[model samples]
Target: MKKLLILGLLFSTGLFQACTVNENPQPITNELLAEVFEVKADFTPGNSFRNYYNLSPVIFDSDVLLVYEFVGLDKTGADIWKPLPQIYTSDNGIHQYNFDFTKLDFSIFLDANFDRMRLNNSWRLGKTFRVVIVPGKFAKMVDKNNLQNVMNTLKLTESSVVDLTI
Candidate 1:
C-alpha cells in the first residue's frame, strides 16, 4: 500500500511538472490570417443576370470564399451583414442573393422563382457586400453561415476590411 501511494505521488508530480505555464504567454498569432473586403456595386442583370469581379491579389486554390450582403442598419445604426445565399419571399415570389468564386474572381447574382424582372430595380442597384477569404483549413473550424463567428475566428473587424468599388 505504501509503495502504491509513493508511485501515485511521483506520477502526479510528473504530470504537474509537465504542465508548465508560461510566465509571459505570447499572444497566438496566425501568419496566414483571413482577408476581408467590402464591395459596393450594382448588379446589372442583362442576358445572364450575373456580375463578376476580379480578386486583386489572387487567393490560393485551397482558400474558400464567403459572401455576405449588407441588409441594412441595426437599431444602433451599425451596419447589419447577413451571409448568403440569402432568400427572401416577396409578394411576387422567392428571390435569392448568392455568389460563386474561383481563385481569380467571384460573381454575384440574383435568382427568383418568379420572373426576376418583377423584382424591384432597387434590389439590383446600389448593393453592398462583404467578401471573406478564409483559408480552407480555418473554414472547417467555424460556422461558415455565421458572419460574426467567421469574423471572430478570423480576428477580423469592420475597420480591417478593404473597400472596393465595382
Candidate 2:
C-alpha cells in the first residue's frame, strides 16, 4: 500500500510538471513591412487604367491578405479605370506581397456613382482585406480589435490607402 501511494504521487507530480503552458507567447521580433503596389493592367476591366494598394503583415505564417482597389471615374458615372486583383503570401509568421495592377487586363469597368462610391469606401470593403493566418493560429474575428491592439503594440502598420483619379 505504501509503495503504491508513493508511485501514484510521483506519477502525478511528473504529469503536472510535464503539462506546462507557454507563459510568454513568442513576440514578432523581425521587422515586417508592407509596400503599396499597382495591379497588373491585364486584370483591369476593359483594359481600363486604375490604381491598387495592399497591406501585407510582416510576420511569416500570418496568412493574412489585405487588398484595396481604387477606380477612376468620369463625370458621367462611367468608370475610366479600375483596380486589378492583388496577391499576398505568408511564410511562417510573416506576410508579404504587392498588388501589381499595372500588369493585369480585364473587361468593362464597374460604374461608380454617388451612393455606390460611399459603399465602395466602407469598412466592409476594408474587411475584404484579410490575412490568412492558420486556422488555430490567429485570433478570433471578434478579437479583431485586440489583434489591432497587438499590431499597434508591436509597432506594425495596418495598411495604406491608395488614391485613384480619372
Candidate 3:
C-alpha cells in the first residue's frame, strides 16, 4: 500500500507538470489580421437589379482572401438572422461579388447559404451584411474549422449596413 501510494503520487505529479497553459501565446499580428472589408448593400427594385448588385467592388490592397456573410435585414427583435453560410470573398482577386437579389425566390438558398441571399427588393426596402477580411493563412486560424468560431468572430463587427454609394 505504501509503495502503491508513492507511485500514484509520483505519477499524478508528473501528469500535472505535463499539463501547462501557454503563458505567452502568440499574438495576432498585422500580418495575421488585415483590415476588415466593408460592404454596404442597399435595396433596389427586383426589376431594376434583376441581374446583380450594381455597386462598386469593395477592393482591398494586398488582401489575399476575404470572408463575410449576410448579417440580417434589421437590427431589432424578430430579426431574420442565421449563421447558415459563409461567403468567401475570393480565392481569386474577386473580393467583389455581384449580389443577386433575385435568389430570394428560393428560401433554401438563404437557409443553406445565408450569405448568398439577395435582398427582397419587393418586400424589404434594404438589407445588411457583415464582412470579415483576412489573409488566406489566417482565415482558417480565425474560424478553427468551426462555425461557432466564425459566428463569434462576426460579433466583432458591431453592426452591418449597406452603403449604396460605396
Candidate 3 per-residue lDDT, tens place, 1-166, comes to 9999999999999999999899999887552344333344443344332223321233244333332334444555433433323333322221122232221110111221232234333222333443344445556557534333543564433333233223
Every candidate's lDDT: 0.84, 0.34, 0.39
Identify the candidate with maximal TM-score: 1
Worst 10 residues of 1 by lDDT: 40-49
In candidate 1, what are the lDDT values of residues 86-137, reduced to their tens digit? Answer: 9999899898889999999999888888888777878877788999999877
Candidate 1: pairs in clash: none
- The 10-residue segment of model 3 with minimum total lDDT is 103-112
Between prediction 1 and prediction 3, the one with superior TM-score is: 1
TM-score of 1: 0.75
Sort by lDDT, best first. 1, 3, 2
Which portions of model 3 show Cα errors greater than 4 Å? 1-28, 43-124, 144-148, 151-165
Give lDDT for model 1: 0.84
Q: Write the per-residue lDDT of candidate 2 for residues 1-166, one digit (tens) a residue.
A: 9999999999999999999899999765424332222232222233232324322323344333333333344699643322224322223222212232221211212232222233323311222222222222433432332333334433444353233222
Between prediction 2 and prediction 3, the one with superior TM-score is: 3
